[model samples]
Target: MTASYPHTRLRRTRATAWSRALHRETTLTPADLIWPLFVTEGVQVEQPVAALPGVSRWSVDLIVDRAREAVELGIPVLALFPNTQPDRRSEDGAEARNPDNLMCRAIRAVRDALGDRIGLLTDVALDPYTSHGQDGLIDDAGYVLNDETVEALVGQSLNQAAAGADIIAPSDMMDGRIGAIRAALENTGHSNVQIMSYAAKYASAFYGPFRDAVGSRGLLKGDKKTYQMDPGNTEEALREVAMDLAEGADSVMVKPGLPYLDIVRRVKETFAVPVFAYQVSGEYAMIEHAVAAGAADRDAMVLETLLAFKRAGCSGVLTYHAAHAARLLHG
Candidate 1:
């Protein structure tokens, strides 16, 4: 239809790819991607996670190869998760502090191979090392003990840093652990090690695949509702972010990305820090299965979901799709 002098046309910019690119508000690239890799004990293994297609539990030697690939791809960071052997899982999660544990070994292997070309982010939680599959040690009542857990986390953080981890990420969601870990890091002369707190982590149902990836699903004795935030609240997430920031978090994360992009936006808006999001295991699995079911184009869906995080004000995202997205972006 013909328009009058005062009429406006919104589709002009959307008419062409070049026009759309020039008018775009958010851009996704490999630099904004942080690949999350799972490490299991071995030399040349790539254990497929059946629940999480295209994801695997790589061994130490192969992890070095992953680090080299990340360096080549311009992906600035790689978050490492460990699948502890059955015999190594303990009640106190004491293996978490071992200098030569699976996680520590993976961190060292990567750091030694790639140097500082890519940041090695180690998850500072005990779920992978615990017999009960809880992030913290539980008492007779099966309730997670806060103070004790903080101590264990502090030890875990120090151990990771000692193993040359560039960032110590506390994903446990326990109270007072950030400050304690920071203080411990400084006291141990590892003051430059960054702390990326999983500040607004919600106890959401989207973590099943993650638990499976880390081999913790079956061992989980109870849920983490007492520690991780409830999914029904928003104000509480801000409070959690604020507390973590004030406690000396170098940066903060909002987990289970798509479901909590609101929290990511609010965190970036309010704190004005380098807020990050985790395009977690379940999210990855859903997209993979959707592509398998022919619901959406795989490449398009991956980039769209990642760009949503950038539009919501995230500095970067920890995603399993980092490699695929990087290759697409490069192409």
Candidate 2:
């Protein structure tokens, strides 16, 4: 007799845990995470960011201890951001070139304490150092100038490189900055330093908590619509990725990860490069809020969200929950 309606059982494979596991397409592990940490000036202090629940701005001393914990958890890298003090903020952002600046100091301390046991990535941008909270230098007309900002970025990149930054991450989104930075690194003999370009950074509402963490929320006079990519565009992202790759980016990143998994997938498939994503501040806060409201299981939500990145073809993720998630994975 011919097969009937009940002949095919599609759910048979899912009937057993081993079968389900074998068919799983995505997985999360400790190696697929890069912890993003916030730094402030002081000793032994951990200031909690109000908007980003469970996240803190640590001092260099406390960060060293945190680095040790991350190493123990098998997380391969850590990205650093600084909460630059008001007095240090300037129109020219000259403090960014200071070798003893807070970010550089933290980089040096972590490298000295851990060496090659963990990779240290540093943020190279003027937003934290500028009084106006813009990523680049502003002209008299209040417009951000591309070439001027590239000059400052070169100085900032070399400064971080001198402090032992293993990866120089330029999140500014300024045109031609990647090529300029690559040339500067080669000339400065930091040829081994990797460049993880924020190749498709979007100007989304998802950055509120991150601004608060860096103390730039109230300082930004206007939106960053000119430089950052519009959230409505997709083809522009591929063009940006192509430019960065042509300029010699070691890897590329997609920001605000989950909402743009399509972009992540497209970039990875088109370029066949090491693609990464940033589970940005607002995304982190939203998940935490849902968990707090009893709408979601915290541990399950974290693991599920992280696994989604892998399924979307992200080589790794820069996430606020890296440490806690790493602990869960290790357990």
Candidate 3:
């Protein structure tokens, strides 16, 4: 079988680990990770998210400590999601606008504890604060209203910014919210704050574990098809990314990362902006289950899956595996 092709041996570089490392095309590191932390009420409590094996919902006091650990690991950012008490959940998600709310308080606490040691990203969606869990104000007909939701998102973004949030991430997918939030941030003198819009969030079944983390699954009355994009279409994702960029999004995200890596690649290719991906709750859970079942190696799977994002043209990724992956990379 070894004929004239024997002259071109590809095994030379693959013979040594050092040689392979020197020739690696893409490198994964702690700097590329963004840890998603769930914020709840109380002082030092850490509640495990049942659906997501290694993840937990920590109170503000404990979250400050976690943020410090993330900084020590060279992880640059932490995205905050709140688990509001049932009593605080309202139809209009008015609690989201309160400057002293759980999310805002956590943002301030982390900022004060670590200063600018790490970037603080606060979620601007209302599903965590709403009883109906629609991510926006629901009409009598059960439809998620786009314009009205944008107005509330503006208020939510302003509140987070007032609490010292470094970035206002609009995950609600409501039309025109990015422009409105950008304008609000400017008017409120937060001109330097960044906007990372969840521009191509598809309505996917992979969001179940995420809903459980925010305590929104059981409260959700119906599907969010009206707002989040349909998974069947890819051109629509390009349009959404373009619109968000035009509206002043500093970076754009394609959610449920593994399933939509194609969308990530396409958006990055067409728009040439900073494209981020969310290795969402269910994706984490699936890998965890396989590892637990002895079907896969945890360390190998984590690094491979993360490198997949890099290969697919992601600038950064929001992942629950950030700390673990960072430790592996640093090792």
Candidate 4:
């Protein structure tokens, strides 16, 4: 007689912890995380970002301490964003090229303290340095000029490289900036520096908390629709990735990771390159609030959410929960 039940039972493997572990399709670990830290000025100060909950804007001195902690946690990299003071903001974002500026200084401090133990990544954008909060120079018509921005980004990338930045992530989305930065790196004897372009960065509402953390919240006069990708588009992401790869990006990133996992999956499958995602500040706050409200278990939710990115084929994630999640994994 024919069997009443199916021959294959998927739940059999999931019935035990060991079985589940052996059959797991995706694995997440501390090495898969890249911590994004906010850099501010001064010493002995760590300002908690209200919107981002556990996140903080640390001073250059404090950043080195955090870098030591990150090394202990096994987190492989740190991406830095500066909260440039108002007095330093400029129309042309000239401060970005200053090797002694906040971002550059933080990079040097962390590298000097940690040496080659952890990779240092820096943002090659003008938003944090611009008086008007635009990512690049704009004309009287309020239109962002592309070529001028690319030139500035090249200078920014060189400055970061000089300060020991291992990766130059161009989040500004300016046209041809990746190729420009890549060439500048090679020509200036920084051939070892990597360009991890924000190839598919979307102009999403999910970045509000990040703006606050970086001190660009109230300063932005208008939206970044001119450069950043539209959230409504998908295929455009692949094209953007292709262009950036052609221009010499060592890796490409998809922003606001959870909401855009489909894009992450597509890009990973299409290019087969090292794909990364940014679990932006808003996503971090949402999960934290849910846990605070008793709507989710903190440890379970964080690990599961992180594993989902791995299942979606992301090689690594730039997340706010790096250290906390690393502790859970190690435990």
TM-score of each: 0.98, 0.97, 0.98, 0.98
lDDT of 4 by residue, 154-173 (tens): 99999999989999999999
Q: Write the per-residue lDDT of candidate 1 for residues 183-281, one digit (tens) a residue.
A: 999999999999999999999999999999999999999799999999999999999999989999999999989999999988999999999999999
For candidate 3, the C-alpha RMSD (Å) to the true structure equals 0.9
Candidate 2 regions exceeding 4 Å error are 1-8
Write model 2 residue lDDT over 169-247, tens digit each, in one string. Answer: 9999999999999999999999999999999999999999999999888888688999999999999999999999999
> After aligning candidate 2 to the native by TM-score, how far in Å is the CA of 319 from where it should be?
0.5
Off by over 4 Å in 4: 1-6
Enumerate clash totals for all models, in the order shown. Answer: 0, 0, 0, 0
TM-score of 4: 0.98
Cα lDDT tens digits, model 3, 1-331, are 6587677778888999999999888888899999999988887799999899999999999999999999989999999999999999999999999989999899999888888989999899889999999999989998998999999999999999989999889999999999999998899899999999999999999999989989999999989998899999999999999999999999999998999999999999998999999999989999999999999999999999999999999999999999999999889
In model 3, pairs of residues that clash are none
Candidate 2 lDDT (Cα, 0 to 1): 0.94
| lDDT for position 114 in model 3 | 83
Positional deviation of residue 223's Cα in model 4 after best superposition, in angstroms: 0.5
Ranked by lDDT from best down, the candidates are: 2, 4, 1, 3
Mark the 10 consecutive residues where model 1 has the least summed lDDT: 1-10
